[model samples]
Target: MAISIQIDRVSREYGPVKALDDVTLDIRAGEFFTLLGSSGCGKSSLLKLIGGFDRQTSGRVAFDGKDVGNLPANRRPVNTVFQSLALFPHMSVAQNVGYGLRLRGLSGSTLETRISGALDLVELSGFGQRDVNLLSGGQRQRVALARALVMEPGILLLDEPLTGLDERLRQQMRDEFGRLHKRTGATFILVTHNQDEALSLSDRMAVMHRGRIEQVDAPARFFEAPANAFVARFVGIDTLLRPERIVATGNHAEATIAGQTLPVRVEGPADLAASVVAIRPDRLFLAPQGMPPALTLMVVGTTFRGLHRDLKLAFSDGQTLVIAIEADADIGQLSAGQQVSVGLKPDAAVLISSAGLPPA
Candidate 1:
C-alpha cells in the first residue's frame, strides 16, 4: 500500500526571497500528483522540501501521520529521479540498478534477484549486462526509473524528469511511466512546467504561482472551470475583455464593435459593476453574412498557421479578438481592413473577476 504525503502550511525562504508561501495540500495514496508552474514558481523548492533535500522555513511535512519535517533526504521514504539521469558510465546496467541494494549489504542471489526484478519491471529485463552508454535515451530513462523503484520507496518524486527527451520519446516515456505507476502502485509526485505533461500524466495537479498555490484539481475540472482570471489565462491562450464593454440587458450580454452588438453569455454578478469576460479563440464564430443586431467586427489581419489560420480582428470600439479557423476555410474573401461581424453563443463566454490585468 502507498503512504500519503501531507504538506501543511509549508513556507520556505532563501534569505530575502520567499520561495514558497503557506502551501498546504495532500497527496492521496497511489495518486499521481503534479506541481506545475513556470520557472521560479517554487515548484522545485516544494519538491525538495517533500524529499527532505531542503528544509522549510515554517510548517511541517508529514508522511503517514509522522512529522518528517526534519528528516534527512536519505532517511525519508522517498526517491527522486532528477532531470539528469545520473547513471554511472563505469558500471553495467545491473550494477547501476543494484548499487543501492549492494550498499545496504545485500549480496549473492538476493541482490541479483532484486536487480533482475526491477529491470523486468522497467521492461529492460534482458539488458542488465549491457553498457549504460549503449542504451537509447528512453532506455536510459527507464533505467533511472528502475534504479529508483528498486528501493521500493513509499513515494517517487520526479523533477522535470522528461525535460531532455525528444517529442516522440517523451510521449513514449510518458506512456511507460503511466504503466509503471499502475504496476508499482506507489504514490508519484511530479514537478514540471510543461502543461501538457502535467495534464496527461497527473491524476490531480496544483498550479503554483509566485510561491503560492493558485489552484489544485483534476486536469479536466481545472481546465473547464478555472478558479480565477490568472488561472484561466495561464492555462490556455485567450483574450480578456473589459467588464463595462459587456452591456447586460435581459438574459443576454452584448459587446458592440464596428456598429454591431455581439451577443455573449455571462453568469453570476448580474449586478456586476466591474467584470471581465474570457473567450477562447475557437468560441468565436465567423459567418458569411454579417449579423448587425448581434455583432460587428473588422478584420485587421490574418496569419496562416499550418492547420489553422489565426484571424485578428479589431472592433469599431478598438477592442481586439483572435479567432482560430480551419486553414482551408474560404478566408480569401477576408482581408486586412475588411468589415465583418463575429458571432458567439450567449452561453459560451466565461466571466471572471477583474481584480487583475486582462489576459496577455
Candidate 2:
C-alpha cells in the first residue's frame, strides 16, 4: 500500500550553492506524482532526500507522519529505481532482481515467491532465467521495477529511467509503467524533465526551477493557467506579447498587434507595462476581419505540421506571430507574403503578469 509524504522546509546545500532551497510539498497516498523541470533544477535532489540516499541540510521529511531524515536507505520504507536500471549484466534477471533479498538474508521458497509475484506484476513472468543483457531496454526497465517492487515499499521512486531508452521503447515502457502503478497501488514519485511524460502519467505534477517549485497542479490546469511567464514558456507557450504593444482596459487589455486592437485578459497583477500576453499556437484560429475580434497579419512563412499548417506572421511593427490553421481550412491560393486575418474567441489569449516572470 501507498503512504503519504510530507517534506517541510527542505534544503540541501553544497557549500554556498543551494541545490534545494526551502522546498516543501505534500504527496498524497497512492497518488502518481511527478517532479518536472529542466536540467540543473533541484528535482533530483528532492528525490534523493525522499529516498534517504542523501541527508537534507535543513528541514524535515516524513513518511506517513513519521520523521525519516536520519533513517538510512535500508531503513526507509521506500525503494528507488535509478536511471541506469542498475541490474547486474552478468546475473540472470531473477538473480539481479533478488540481489536485495539475498543481502537481507532472505532465501529459499519465500524469497522466490516474492520475486515471482513482482515479475508478474511487471508482466515479466517466466523470464526469470533470461540474461539481463539479452532482454530489450523496456524489459530491463521492468526488471529494475520488479526489483524495487519486490521490496513492497510504500513509495516507489523512479529517476528518469526511460531517458536512456529509444523513443519507441520509451513509449512502451511508459505504458507498462502506468499499468504497474495501477497494479501495485503504490505511491509513485517520478522524476523527469520531459513535459509530455509528466503530464500524461502523473495525477498531479510540480514544475520546478532553480531549487524552487513554480507551480503544482493537474496537467490540464498547469497547461491552461500556468503560474507565471517562466512556467508558460517552459510549458511550450509560443507567443510572447511585449508590454509596449498592449494597453490595459478594465479586466482585459487592448493589444495593438498586426495593426489591429484585440482584447486579451491580463492575468496576475495590474501593471500594463510590466504584464505580458501569451496565446497558445493551437488556440489561434484563421478567421475573417468581421469576426468579434480580428487581426490581420502578413504571412512571412508557412510549414506543414501534420494536422495543421504553422503560419509565421508579422505585424506592421515587425513583431512576429504564429498561428495554426487546420489542414482542411480554405487556402486555395494561400502563400507566403499574403495578408490574412485571424481571430479568436475572448478566452483564447492569455495575459501573464511580468512580476512572476524571471528578470531579463
Candidate 3:
C-alpha cells in the first residue's frame, strides 16, 4: 500500500522567515527518495509538512493525489525515525515495538505476533526481553526501525537516522534500510545532509539549497549531467575550467584552454560566454609519449591517498586541477616542479554554465 506524494507549490513560513519557498515535487510510490542539503536548507521543514508535524502557510501537500494538509500527524499514515531515537528506556524491546499497535486496540496474541514479526524484520528476533538501555548503538537503531515498521506505515520518513553511528555501523544500517524497503514496499523518504548517504541509498535524490530544490534526478544523472554549477561541485566534479574559446556542433565541442584545444561533450548548444569546461578525474590520464598531449602542465604537488596518489597539476597561468593515478604506477621521474603531458578521454570534458554559482 505504498503511496505517491505530490507537493504542489508548498511554502512553509515561520513569522517572517520562509523555510520552504514555492517548492513543488512528486515522489512515486515505492520509490526511495532523498532530500539532500546542508543545515538551514529547509529539507527538514518540508519533511515536517509531509509528516503533518507542521503545516504550510501556502500550497498543498497530498498523498496519492488526495490533499491532506489539514490532517494531524497521528491521522496520517506516516511514520518517522528521528535522529534522537526516542526509544523508551523503561520498556523492553517487545513493549516498545508493540506500543503503537496496542494504542490502536491490538492486544494479546495479535500484539505478540506483530511484535515478533517486527523484531524479526529488523533481525532482532531473540532480543525481545532485553532492556532497551542495555542494547548497543546499532541494536538501538534496529529497535527504532522495528518500532516504526511494526505499524506497517505506507510512508517511512527517515530524518538523519544514522547521524551518530560509527562508520561500520552506519554502513551496516544503510544496507539494512535497502533490504527493508524491498521487504515492506513502502515509499521511503530520507532527509540527510551527508551526500554519501543520499547518493548510496536513494533511487533518485533532490539537492536543496536556500529553501529551494536545485536539482532532482537519479543519482547517476547528478554526476553525468548536473543541472548547474552548484550541482556539479556538490556531486564531486571539481575541475571547472573557463575555456577561452569553444567551437560547438551538436553534442560535440572543442574547448580551447591555456592554448590547448580539447574535445568536450555537451548536451545542447552551450552558451559560450556563460559556460565553463568541467573535467572529471576518471576521464583524465597521463598522455602517452608517442601521442600528441592535450595539455602539458607542471606537477605542483602530490598527496598520498592510500589506493591512489593525487597530483596537483597547474597551467602556465596558475590554474590548477587534481588528477589521481594508481599508487604503484610507474612515475619515471615525475615529481614536483616537473612538466607532465596530460590527455583527456573523448567527451570527458563537459561544458557547463558558470552563472552565480558557489565553489565546492
Candidate 4:
C-alpha cells in the first residue's frame, strides 16, 4: 500500500540550536522523493521525524491524512534502511530477511514464502542459505533491503544506504532501487548528500541548508530555476559574478569584471545591487566574427575531460570561470595565457538571490 506524508512546519531543537526550523513539505503517494543536503543541515533530522524515531519539538507530521506525530516507531507503517545495514552477524541471509516477519508472529510456510519473495525482488535468489558474512557488500545490502521489504511497510526510508558501497556497487544499487520502486509502488524517502545521486534517482527532491528548505522541485526544474544563490553554486553553476560588478538594466544587465563588460539576463526585482549572476558552463560559446563577444576572459588553465574540454578562465580581477567545450570544437588550438571573446545567450545568465527563498 502507498501513503502520502506531510511535514507541517516541523521543528527540532537540541537545547540552544534548532535542527529543523519551521519546515513544511509534502510527499505524494508512491513517489521516490529525496531529501538532499550537506551534513548538519537538518535533512537527517527531518527524516528521523518522519520515521517516528525522533519527535519534533513543534508542528505536525501526518501520514495518509492521519496525525502520526504521537505514533511510536513500532506502530508506524514505515521501515528504515540505515547506512550501517545492521545485519545479524551469525544469521543466514534468509533468517535476517525474515527477522521482522518472525517478530510479528508469522511463521510456517507462509513466512518462508514471503522471505523468498523478498530476496528474489532484490535479485538475490538462491542465496538465502548463505551466511551474511560470506555475502559481498552489494549482496549484504540487498539482504538488508529484503528485510525491510518483507515487512511490507507503506513507506520506506533509506538513510544513506549506498554511502558505504564502492563506486561500481553504488551504481548497481541505484539501478536496483529504481527497479524496486517501480515494482512495489511504495513511497520512498531517501536522504543523501550526493547531488548526482539525488538528481539521478529522485522523482523530486528537497534541497536543505542550515535547517531550512531551500528548494523543492523536479531535478530538471531545480537545475534550471534555482530559487537562490546557494542552489546555483551547489548545482554546478560555474560562473558567478560579484554583485558589485553587476550593473542593472531592466530585464537585462551587464557584468563588468577584469576590465571586460558582458551582457546578462536579469531576474526578479532590480532593487538588489548586490545580487550575483550565475552562468552554467554549457551556456558559454566562443564568439566568431559574425557574433559579438559578451565577455572577454583570459584563459588560465585547461583540462581534458574525455567527452569535453574544461577551460578555466580568469577575469581581470582574478576571479575564475569554468567553461565546458565539446571535445571536437575548434578550441583544439586554444591554450593558456590567451585572451578570448566569449558569448553568453540572453537566457543563459540567471541573477540568483544571495539567500534562499521559502517554499511558495
Candidate 5:
C-alpha cells in the first residue's frame, strides 16, 4: 500500500550545522514528489530523515500520521536508490535483484519469480543471468531500479539516480522513472539538483534553498506565477523590470518603464516600490508595423541558438532583457545600438515582489 508522509517542524543538526532547519511538508499517498535545489540545500538531509537513516534533532517525521523518527532504515517501509547504484558487480543481474529477498529467506521458485517480475517491470526481462559488471550504464541503472522496486516498499526514494548518465541516457531514464511511478502506485520522493529532472518527473515539487523550502507548487505554476523574484529567475523568467511608475486596477496594472507604459498582470494589491514586472520571453515579440509599440529599445546583442535567436535589448537606463525570435525570421538588419520596437502580449508582464516570500 502507498503511504502518506508528514514532516512537521523537522530539524536535523550535525554538531553546529543545521542540515534541515524546522522544515514542514506533507506528501500525499502515491503522488510523485520532488525535492529540488542546488547542493547543500538540505534536500538530501530531509530524505535521510524520511528514510530513517538519520533522525531529526527536533520535530517529528511521520508516515500516515504515525511517528517513525525512531525507526531504523530497515524497519521503515522505504527504499532508496542512491546515485552510486552500489550494485554487487561480482554478481549476476538476477542475483543483485534478488539479494534482499534471499536475505529475508526467500528462495527456490518463489525468489526466482520475484526477481523475474522485478526485472520485467524495469524492461530487463531476459538479461537476468548476465554479469552486472559488463552491462552498459543505462542497463546498470535499470538493474539498480529493479533492485529497489523488488523490495516493494510503500515509499521509494530516488537520490540523484541519473546523476552520471549522458544527456540522452538521462532523458531515457527520466521517462522510465515516470513509467515506473505509474506502474507501481508507491509514493515517490525524488531528490535532484537538476531542474529539468524535477520539472519533468514531479507531479508537484518543492524548491529548497539554505536548509529551507523557497516554494512548493506544480511545474506550470512556477512558470506562470512564481512565488517571488528568486523563483522567477530559477524557472527561466529572467527579465524583471523595476517600473518607474505603476497604476493599479484590480488584477491588472499599467507600469511605466523607459518612458513608455505597458500593461501588466497582478495577483492582488501591488506595492509600487516593492513590486517589479516579470516579463516572459515567450510573451515578447516584434511590434506590428501598423500598431503602436509598447516600448522601443536599442538592440545590444544577439546570439544564435539553432532553432531561435536571442536578442538582447537595452533600455535607456542600461537595463537589458533577452527575447527569443525565430532563427529564420528577418532581423539581419538589426545591429548593436539600433532602435527596435517591441510588443508585450496582454497580461504577459506579471507584477511580482522583488523580495523573496515565505514558502507555501
Candidate 6:
C-alpha cells in the first residue's frame, strides 16, 4: 500500500541555532521525493523529523493527515537506510535483511522465506549467505536497501545512501533504486548534496537553502525554470551577468550585455536588489560572425573540457561572463585580451535575482 506524508511547519533547533525553520512539505504516495541541499541546510534534519528520529520543536508531522509528531521512532511506520550502511560486521546478508523482522520476534522458515523474498526484490536473491564485508560497495548498499525494504514500511528514508560510492557505482545504484521504488510502490525520500543524483533520481525535488525550501518542482522544470537566485546558483548555473542590463516587460525581458541587447523570458521578479542574467554552460554558443554592434567583450581565457571548451570573457566595463562553446569551434582564433562581440539568444539564458535582503 502506498502512503502519503505531510510535514507541517516543522522546526528543529540545537540550542540557539535553528536547523529547520517553519518547514512544511507534502510528499506524495509512492513518489521518489528528494530533499536536496548543501550540508547544515537542514535536509538531514527534515529527514530525521519525517523518520521520527528527531522531533519538531513547534510543528507537526503527519501521515495521511494523522499527526505522528509525538510518536517514537520505532512506533512510526517508517524505516531508514543510513549512509553508513550500518550492517553488522559479523552478520551475513540474510541476517542483516531479517534483523528488523527478527526484532519483532519472527523466526524460522517464515523468516527465511521473507528474507529470501527481500533479497530477490533487491536483485540479491542468492547472496543472502555471503558475508556483508565480502560484498561490493554497491551490493552492501543494496543490502541496506533490502533491510529497509523487507520491513515493508510505508515510507523509507535514505540518508545519502550513495555518498561513498564511486561515480559509476553511484549511477548504477541510482538506476536500481528507481526500479526498486517502482516495484515496491513505497514512498522513498532520499537526502543528498549531489545535484546530479537528486535531479536524476527524484520524481520531484525540494531545493533547500539555509533552513527553508527555496522551491520544489519536477526535475525538468526545476532545471529549466529555477524559482530564485539560490536555486539557480545551487542547481548549477554558475556564471553571472548584471540584472539591470535585463529590461523586463513581463514574461519577456531584453538584456544588454557588452554592446548587445538580447531577449529572454523572466519567470518572475525576484526579491534581490541586484539581478544577474544566468545561463548554463550548455546553453551558450560561439559564432564566427562578430556579435551584433550592440555587443562587445574581450576574451580573457579558455579551458578545454573534453566535450566542450570553456570561454571566459570580460566586458570593457570590467564585468566578466563565462560561456561554453563547442570544442572544435573556431575559438582558437580568439586570444587573451582580443575584443569580440558577444550575443545571447532568447532561449539561451535566465534572469536570476541577486540577494534582495541586505546582510544583517
Which has the greatest lDDT?
A: 5
All candidates' TM-scores?
0.88, 0.90, 0.95, 0.90, 0.94, 0.91
**TM-score quality measure for candidate 2:** 0.90
- Model 4 off-target regions past 4 Å? 243-269, 327-337, 356-360
Q: What is the C-alpha lDDT of each candidate?
A: 0.82, 0.84, 0.88, 0.85, 0.89, 0.82
- Give the clashing pairs for model 4: 258-316
Residue 290 local lDDT, model 5: 78
Query: How do the residues 1-360 of candidate 1 rate in per-residue lDDT, one tens digit apiece?
Result: 678988999999999999999999998999999999999999999999989989999999999989997789988889888889898899999999999889889999999999999999988988899999999988999999999999998899998989999999898888887888898899999999999889998999999989999889999766455655677677874666664456777657765434554455554343344456666777778865636424567899888989898898886667777888888888878888887866675444666554445343
How many pairs collide in each candidate, listed in order? 3, 0, 0, 1, 0, 7
Cα error, candidate 5, residue 197 (Å) = 1.6
Ranking by lDDT: 5, 3, 4, 2, 6, 1
Q: Which stretches of candidate 2 lie over 4 Å from their true place?
A: 103-105, 245-259, 289-293, 327-332, 355-360
Better of 1 and 4 by lDDT: 4
lDDT of 3 by residue, 175-283 (tens): 9999999999999999999888899989999999888898899998887777767778878888787777898888788888888788887843487667877788777
State the TM-score for model 1.
Answer: 0.88
In the range 1-360, model 4's lDDT, one tens digit per residue, is: 989999999899999899999999999999999999999999999989989999999999999889997799998999989889899998999999999999999999999899999988999999889999988889989999999988988999999999999999999999888888898899999999988789988999999998999999999876566777778777877566664476776767776556676666665443345466677888887788667788788899788889998888888878788888887777756778898888876567777675643321
21-108 per-residue lDDT for model 6 (tens digits): 9998999989999999999999999998888887888888899889997799988889999989899899999999999999999999
Q: By the TM-score metric, which is better: model 1 or model 4?
A: 4
Deviation (Å) of 15 in candidate 2: 1.9
Stretches > 4 Å off in candidate 6: 257-259, 270-274, 290-294, 356-360
- Report the alpha-carbon TM-score of model 5 versus the true structure: 0.94
Q: Encode model 2's per-residue lDDT on 1-360: one tens digit a residue.
A: 799999999999999989999999999999999999998899999999999999999999999999998899888889999988888889999998898888889999988998898888888999999999999888889999999989888999999988999999888888877887898899999999998789889999999999999888888876577677788888887666664577766876777654577777766554556666677787777786577547777888878889988788887778777888876767665677888777776566777766456454
- Output the worst ten-in-a-row residue range by lDDT, candidate 5: 351-360
